[model samples]
Target: MFPQSPSIASASNVDILIVDDEPTNLRVLSTIVRSYGYQVRQAISGIVALRAVQIQPPDLILLDIMMPEMDGYRVCEQLKFNSETKDIPIIFLSSLVSGMDKAKAFQLGGADYITKPFQVEEVLVRIDYQLTLRTLQIQLQQKNNRLREQNERLKQEIEIRQQTEVELRRSEAQLQGRTQQLQQALDELKLAQTQLAQSEKMSSLGQIAAGIAHEINNPIGFIYGNLDYASEYMEALINIINLYNKYYPQPHPEIAKRIQVSELDFVLKDFPKVLKSMLVGAERIRDIVLSMRYFSGYDQAYAQQEDIHIGLDSTLIILQSRIKEQTNRVAIEVKKEYGEIPPVNCYSGRLNQVFMNLLSNAIDAIEEKLEVVEEPFHPIIKICTQLSNSSKQFQDKNTQWVEIRIADNGIGIAPQIQRSIFDPFFTTKPVGKGTGLGLFISYSIIVEQHNGQLQCNSEVGKGTEILIRLPIEVPQSLDVSTTRKVKIAPSSLSLESDIGEM
Candidate 1:
């Protein structure tokens, strides 16, 4: 008899199948397996074991190798081939103890093997091990599935984060673009306001100039008219006196004494000279009044074909007083290199203003330099004008351009300050002495109104040159009649007094 197997009361849920041709051997295995608290089923042959497994599969199969019709190897192989029974653990129990027999049983998918008269305890241990391994494999598969799920969720979260970051960056860029646009609009508004103020000031000055010119024209007309008649009358009186003196060569003593006392000969000779001098002075005054009218641009209501040289000359004449010798310095010399250029179509008054500003600035620069220089310095302002061909310097080949350069040997601007010289409200002059709008307005007049270019080149300790390039013919689309008009004001008639202060 086989030694009794240990009792396993807690393994009641496990089921075992005992298969053999001999009833006694089957009975012995069943008793031992049942003692371990397992449900036991018996089969007499391999065919019977397979049939029984088909009906109800067991957790473990104890098989005998030597059978009457079929062997344990064939039974195990058939059970292993069935999908429903393949996972069941099979143990071989055999009287054939050869190694080949054991190997054949294992090759048929047997989990363990025992010879005849095997210990019951060894059979129980093998069954427990195989069941434990199967349980662990199932648990590992569940853990792997959970890990896969977690990995997929993490990937989704990462994608969401990346998309959110992209959206955030796009929003920031849009905000920055809007901010820049707002800033640009604000700057433009400020510039327009400044220009409007400047225009109003110029307009008021022009109105004042027109009124003064009208007032002075009436008196000047009569004075100029009467001077010619006065000269004729004086000549007639001198002739009468000459005839009387010739007729009365031998005068009475009383007459001779009276003539000597009065210095009659000296009076007769100098009287005509005094009349000539008076006539010359009146003519000079008339010319000055005319030049004042020209410099004021009172007649420029629309764009007209006019000589730029005429405008320059009138401006110079108005500024003559400043150019003359000052108490502290000698006269400032002005050199003109005017080229043979045709008349240009432009607002003559505005052009005069540009010239006035540039010349006044040049004079101011020279005056400032005079204060600092120790050597004998003769301040010179050189103005040159020429026709520019269509080259790299000029963009339009169809249109003719005139280039004017006004240069001054004075306290030149530094490189850093040169860039901002044309900006509104930028100036080097003291607070009460300047308004800082002269150059800025000049630049706007040339570049914006006339579609011209204004450039400045300067070096410290050397000099400054302001270059202006303007088209000779105004564009057909630019309607001068519709443009803002600036007239000469009485106060502005004196370029040196008005613009020089600016």
Candidate 2:
């Protein structure tokens, strides 16, 4: 039926198995496969084909559908069920060329189909297509496995990175917290250093003032005592002259000549007035010395009951030289509107310093305004004191407050600068002219030291008013230690109109 031996040149290395019950069909298919350079195998039945595949799997199988012991469908099903041979390509080659038969072959995992008595070229082409498909499938499966491995590695790397990020965030939070704590400690230390320096400076100034005042007192007392004696001596001499005139109606010629030369009547008339003037000048000096002594009482650190007005008077007296009229400008007029308020419990020396700063600043403002104003301007500093009943209505009803308003008609502070005027080392004056610690220390004294309120209100080109509200009785609970901490909150200085201008 077929060639007994077909001579063909081998051009490829593909392995192909041909299964058929007829020897002619098997021989014809094998010869055609070998001519295409494929290694060929033969199986007489479906059972034999399956056994051949189990023993040695081929790249592709050409199966005949109608077989003796087992059919091609059953053999293909068996081959597909076997994991070892499932991936191998199977093509149906049969004499029965019905559509149903081809469908059954395909359903059982056949890769292709060829009818019996097929042309040699068609069979060879079908086998070549199947072998190529199998090779491509194998390559595709290997690539899929590699991708799966790479995907697993990528997942592990992503998880590790996520864990690293979490740890880094935790470390950052801890470092941030530590940085904040260090910053807070540094700030507190700076504040303490500033306060200590200020206190030492004030203490030194107080000691100097006390020493000068003491030194001045000695000379003043001697001058004052001598003046009183000098006045009495002059009075006694005048009396003696008067008595002599009374005893003798007519003077001796020598005596009369000397008396006339001296102008006795005129001397007698102005002698009392001269003594009175000297006494007045001495008394005034004494008053100034006393004010200095009161102002320089640094040893009086503890709170004591003292006349607030006395401190105000002493401060004004000390600044009297600045308040006087100069050749270039008119004198700054000071108006006092004192109310009937009792003595306040306070640190007298510190309170005096507050008064001095406020008054001095008021004078400076007026002097600054004098330079720009064209109209007739009277520099006025108005000081008012009043006992406020408003505090009695507060939560602490027993607390009595005295409000003191120091107002000046000068070049007013701008709204922006007014807010930070009390901040330490913040000054509007030129360098070396102001240290900017005046108002800051004053605020500390009134608020921190005396538990009071200091507020300011100003209008540009108009004037400024500083209001001080001090408790009549200092709080007993405050620590008097030199190292006592003062808590100053931001925005502590209230800007409000609590006192009206004079």
**TM-score per model over all chains:** 0.67, 0.71
Q: Which candidate has the top score in TM-score?
A: 2
lDDT of 1 by residue, 1-502 (tens): 2322333224676677889999988898889878867789999999989988888887678889888788988888888898888878888888788899888888889988888888777877766776565556556767888888898888899989989988999999999999998987776666667666666666666566656767787787787788789878878988987898889888889988998999988988888798788778777777777767776673355677888898888888878999999898899999898998888888878888889889999999989888888887778888888887662454578877887878888888877777678766778999977777788778777776677777776656566778877888775345432323222111101111111111
Clashing residue pair totals per candidate (backbone < 3 A): 3, 0
Per-residue alpha-carbon lDDT of candidate 2 for residues 380-473, written as tens digits (9 for 90 to 100): 9988898885543235666778988888998888877876888777788889887787888788888887888887777767778888889888
Give the Cα error of residue 12 in candidate 1, in Å: 7.3
The regions of model 2 sitting more than 4 angstroms off are 1-120, 133-201, 224-237, 298-301, 391-399, 473-501
The C-alpha RMSD of each candidate to the native structure, in angstroms, is 9.0, 6.5
Candidate 1 stretches greater than 4 Å from native: 1-164, 248-285, 295-302, 388-392, 395-399, 415-426, 430-441, 479-502
lDDT of 1 at 132: 62
lDDT of 2: 0.80
